[model samples]
Target: MKAPAISLLAGLLFGAGLAVSGMADPARVRAFLDLFGAWDPMLAFVMAGALMPMTIAWLVQQRMPRPIACEAFDLPGTGLLDAKLLLGAILFGIGWGIGGLCPGPALADLAIAPSEAGIFVVAMLAGMTAHRITRG
Candidate 1:
């Protein structure tokens, strides 16, 4: 119960932050990705802001005996950059470049532009399902 409630609150906060930061707008994200063309620097600031807190969180995580709402931290297993990782990253980058909305931004856009974002979310779920079937 505690974990589920905390998860919901965290998700809501994340969506609200994305909405407030203009990341919910696919056009804004596209503008940021357009480096040689009409590049926007606002998203860089937002990324830096996120990284600062995440850096602090990582430091804090090291000292904590256990996670607040879980028995242990579910951290990544390995740091190895392998073929599967590279392929997934390429696919994700291509999707983001063509669609201008990755998972987080797409989820954030759902409340504001349901029809468009819903299509994206459904497609994303389909891709995830395919991956699970193929990989597992």
Candidate 2:
């Protein structure tokens, strides 16, 4: 019960932050990716702002035995640089560069402007489904 509530609250807060920060805007994100022409630095600043708290959380997490809402941290166990990881990174980079709306912002944008985000969301789901089927 507590975990679910905390998860929901955390998700809502993250979505709200993305929306307020204009990270939910695809055009804005695309502009940020653009380097040679009309590049935007706002996203860089937003990412830097986000990294601050995350850095502190990581430091705190290292000292803690258990998470506040969970028995233990469910973090990734490996730091291995293998084919699967490299392939996934490439795929993610391609998607992010092309769509300019990654999962987080896309999900929030669905609520903010469904019409604009609908295609990307649908495509994203289809990709996920395809991955599941192929992975099996």
Candidate 3:
């Protein structure tokens, strides 16, 4: 169908998957990330499980007649790991560690824990705005 419809369905399905997998729960995510503190490995298994399907999906996409969106593939052709890229990754890791929530988890949190999600989203937006202002 239309791009908007496809995007909406994809987002709904992704949110549903996040909810079903307990990614929305910041506590659980934090516990998982705290390898030295709690040493939980279930999250690793969950991530591997998620990756397997995506790996098969990639294989299928390679054999498809054409892209689902009917557009030419415009995959990034960059392998350059510049300073800016490294710094951004460091910042992202710090934020994730501090909040125990990233884009996917933040979106999923809207259904079960709106207050925390709202805070995370607002902060994320503010950071983006601040970066734009500072960069310009």
lDDT scores in order: 0.92, 0.91, 0.83
Per-residue CA lDDT of candidate 1, range 66-95, in tens? Answer: 999999999977788989999999999888
Ranking by lDDT: 1, 2, 3
Worst 10 residues of 3 by lDDT: 67-76
- State the TM-score for model 3: 0.88
Q: Which ten contiguous residues of candidate 1 have the minimum total lDDT?
A: 93-102
lDDT of 2 by residue, 18-119 (tens): 999989988898899899889999989999999989999999999998999888889978687988789888998888888889999999999989987899
Q: Write down the lDDT that model 3 would get.
A: 0.83
In terms of TM-score, which candidate is stronger, 1 or 3?
1
Deviation of model 2 at 37, angstroms: 0.9
In terms of TM-score, the best-performing candidate is: 1
lDDT tens digits by residue: candidate 3, 1-136? 6767888998999999888887777777888889789856767788889998999988998888777775765567778998888999999988887898888889778778899899999999999899999983
User: Candidate 1: which pairs clash?
Assistant: none
Predictions ranked by TM-score, top down?
Answer: 1, 2, 3
For candidate 2, give the lDDT of residue 3.
Answer: 96
Residue 35 error, candidate 1, Å: 0.8
